[model samples]
Target: MSGLMQKEYERVKLHATVMNTLFRKEPSDSESPRLARGQRKTRESFDARSVLKHFKDYEFGSLTIPNIHLSQRFSTGQDLYYQCVAMAALPKS
Candidate 1:
């Protein structure tokens, strides 16, 4: 692999990490103290909007991921499985 491909692979991994973080993790109640009600509401609203935006631009099928080479690496099938896991963990408004 060349430097550019390695960079692209890293980028994709980072993108996957961020997407997983944004959509996968639940807002844990056992974490730090609560936010103000207004703040909580604001976060919920923002998350809802983000989710909607994602859905609007959604295309869950074959993809040409630049660097990651796993044969079945498109954001579909198993990839969909992970994305759904993330989206399911997203907050509702």
Candidate 2:
């Protein structure tokens, strides 16, 4: 009777292991080529000049801020200086 119970317990354990393996979901290792191609197309179509031009037009036309009065260059330089300082302060990996 004890031998039979031990065999039944082993069988049930093996069955549970097999069922878990069969139902487990595996993660995809790589992205589909179609998705990669679509991403590349989107990256290719991004134009920095067009974006800058749009912002420039909005700033001047809507805000009525003349270029001569704008300190954009100075502000950009200041931002870059702070960014550089912050990056330099980060510990090297």
Candidate 3:
């Protein structure tokens, strides 16, 4: 992944991890109004937005081996024993 992608991921992760604590903690009366206003003003709109906008479609590099072979070889629990074998057989792109 590019530096830009890493930066984006970290921004989103920080935003989410920070919000996780905020969401779980009980807000004092003084904190509630400011918090609600922050929600309204923030471009993300909500905590879910931070998480949803990032990581959903992050790169999963191409697996060049035939999809059909992968399916046939690893589709069942018994087949998983063969995945490492199949995986090692595959040439790195």
Ranked by TM-score, top first: 3, 2, 1
lDDT (C-alpha, whole model) for all candidates = 0.42, 0.32, 0.39
lDDT winner: 1
What is candidate 3's lDDT per residue for 1-93, written digit by digit as tens? 432212322333212133433234444646765555325333332557766678678885865653222222222346432232222255456
Better of 1 and 2 by lDDT: 1
lDDT of 1 by residue, 1-93 (tens): 432222334344433433333233355856857667445222222356767777896876885443343322324455544222121133333
Q: Which whole-number lDDT from 0 to 100 does residue 67 have in model 1?
A: 38
Q: Clash number for every model? A: 2, 0, 0
TM-score of each: 0.16, 0.16, 0.17
What's the ranking of the predictions by lDDT, best on top?
1, 3, 2
Which residue pairs show collisions in model 3?
none
Candidate 1, poorest ten consecutive residues by summed lDDT? 82-91
Give lDDT: candidate 3, residue 57.
Answer: 85
**Model 2 ranges with Cα > 4 A deviation:** 1-45, 57-87, 90-93
